[model samples]
Target: MFPKTSLHTLFPTVNFTEITAIDMSVNSDFFREDPLHENLDLAREKITKFQNKYPMSLLANGYLEERAFYNTPNFERTLHGVKEYRNIHLGTDFWLPESTAVHVPFDGTIVIAHDNNYHKDYGPLLVLKHETETAPFYTLYGHLSKESLVISPKGKNVKQGELLAYLGSEEENGHWVSHLHFQFITDLLNETENYNGVAFPSEIEKWKKLCPNPSVLFEEEF
Candidate 1:
């Protein structure tokens, strides 16, 4: 099992003061219903076209929606056959664009940084490990620029707020609007470079128990 740790103890002075404030009400409507549900056929075609054109990430400011936790549909049916059924978003995502510079939240070691061309989910991604006096944890920075994967070394150390990598566009990242999929994980499950931070509706309970609300760590006005 991976070591347990409190996020607070890891960065005593870190706070969400640096982020821009966001109005959840305004953005909430954007995802009220899965865009894919409106018209699956048209949506898929649009997604394909968007994937081929912009092919880059987007840049914007947004906040983490706590309500999204319990709002996910279904609970048990989605994870039925999977060996690991923890489905639910375990991290807080900041809706933004591609090519955005992703800075290190704090001092940590780069555990895994790679790309997934076939998955079309995470796209270019990076994982950093931070060990606090009380516990150790990892952070996932997903949907990043393909160039971000080119780094110094696998186990290189990064300074606080340092440039880790730039966000990728939709084409390079999994087919979605440009945004940074950030999440905190307690256990990596032997995943050297990447781990699934999002879960199916059925796996929500399991993920909720394993992954806490990241907003607790980054509670800025936005």
Candidate 2:
């Protein structure tokens, strides 16, 4: 079984209280209206501008919109009959610049940390393991700087809230705009350090089977 509890219980220094919630209502004055109805484009533009001005990655660029639950795009069907473009995000994104220090939220062994060009989804990534008395769980840090993995060897144990890696930028981070895509997982499918946390609208049930809400562990209500 997976452990669904506050990461703070394991790492006292991870201060989720300092993290702010991002509001994603379309009715907000900050919401930009687009004639093309390409909300993602408008969102990306606004977030990029905000990121340029803020010291930390501003929430404007990559905040989760509840509409994502229903606004998934449609594309050619895969062999599994799953729409290729309809993956609803199962994790929250933190759009920050490259080299943002990624701290471990809890003590765990580095299970997997590697880079691959397979889909370019998460350019370079790291997955750490955490075990509690009740269950074991894992946390994934995506779009990480190349140097982040260079310093830490696989199987190394990291302390709670310790500096794990720095954030990767758009250039090296799977060609997407800068951000850290973090997710919590219960079962890793017998794979170390690599797992897909995103899911097509049709695969929500499958994703839910593999990945659970990370917010439960973070305990920061959005």
Candidate 3:
């Protein structure tokens, strides 16, 4: 969906060339039958490796991990509540250390900011609504620090690449790795601070229209 739209750089503060892509396919140790991602201890070790390797951030743009992103018991309780379902990831996962600066993708307004804390959930989330003459969309940054809980006025205008928020710790950042769950949204569907970051395989088409592929922002350089 993003290919048709001319999207601008999301983080003007950071150097895009420094960002690196991480492969979570079967080839990687993390994707093996019993991968490191399945356990918190091993996951932390891997995160430390990423922190040392990529100072900018670790990007997991197109990771479809066998339909388990939302299928876990924790995710089911948070998103579905009743139905036990998991969905494939739809946005670029920017893995950064705690307090990493999160910038406004484009000229936009603060639509929503709240703490959506749940294990393996988007703990503290922010939704920035952008409406340019040529481009109109929203950027969702999840797993932000508690400071993001009270970012600013709901309708305040934010410039492109402004210091928007900072990354939160694992305790506040949904018990997963310390990273930003960045998703692009074309429609809010009445969702304010928190929205579905995972999409069931059956609903990928619908979610795609609402959340465009954010990897387009880095495809050229990577």
Candidate 4:
């Protein structure tokens, strides 16, 4: 049996969905250098402006396709190693105001909650272990406020729709827009508090099975 979704199906009161809540570009250019290349302040101001222009509090940029931005000089600086890097995003980003209360979608165990303080990365990360109808899956919450991880420890159990964490500010959350990188995964690759949120184009097939599409698809209806 497949795992039943808790983020959208289980909780009716919370009003969370991957649907066109904000039409936050279900297919966003995750590594679009055009946006980040020019004056960052103006770019952020526009993004902040567009954030509230929609009804949904989050933008679900679900499993995206590969685009060529890695070889560029500007993007290359973000690389750490000489090996090939994964650029395609694998998670749904919740673009909302800072300090938003992030609720757990299912009853799960807090496997690991640690602050991944890296520039242009997920600041404070938290991963939960959940047992569904068929198997035990994992959920990752990234770009969280530092305080959220400070109080959250390993081996803690959380219920569905519970106040799990808070959104981090740009300065704190890897210097990006304030949002929650919420993702569901089947295999954890032996990782505890961390997992790859992006994937290589060649590995998309394997990842597709692990990162299933949300029932409520975020599309442009308008």
| Model 1: per-residue Cα lDDT over 1-222, one tens digit each | 333333223323223223432322223543345532233345345434543443332212322233342332322243345533223445655554456566777678988877866433578878888888877787788788888888524688987756778767767886655567777776777887567666654556666666665554543322
Decide which is better by TM-score, 2 or 4: 4
Query: Arrange candidates by TM-score, highest first: which order?
Result: 3, 4, 2, 1
Model 3 global lDDT (CA atoms, 0 to 1): 0.67
lDDT tens digits, residues 1-222, model 3? Answer: 333222224544445345566766435555444442557667767667765777655455444433433456554433455464555676678766688787665677888888888777788888888775666678788888888766644777887656788889888887777777888778888976578887766667888888776755444443
In model 3, which regions exceed 4 Å deviation? 1-16, 25-28, 31-38, 50-58, 63-69, 74-84, 218-222
- CA lDDT scores, all candidates in order: 0.57, 0.61, 0.67, 0.63
RMSD of each: 8.5, 5.5, 4.4, 5.1
**Model 4 spans > 4 angstroms off:** 1-18, 21-33, 37-40, 55-58, 65-85, 214-222
Q: Over all chains combined, what TM-score does candidate 4 have?
A: 0.75
TM-score-best of 2 and 3: 3
Q: Give TM per candidate.
A: 0.65, 0.71, 0.78, 0.75
Tens digits of per-residue lDDT, candidate 4, 10-32, equal 22333543433332232445334
Q: Tell me the deviation in Å of residue 213 in model 1.
A: 1.3
> What local lDDT score does residue 152 receive in model 4, on the 0 to 100 scale?
63
What pairs collide in candidate 3?
70-86, 71-86
Over 1-222, each residue of candidate 2 has an lDDT whose tens digit, in order, gives 443444344234323333443444344444446422245456567666654555332342122333332232332256565445444566667655567677777788888888744334677888888988887888888888788888656899998657788877666776555667888778777886467645555667777757766666654443
Sort by lDDT, best first. 3, 4, 2, 1
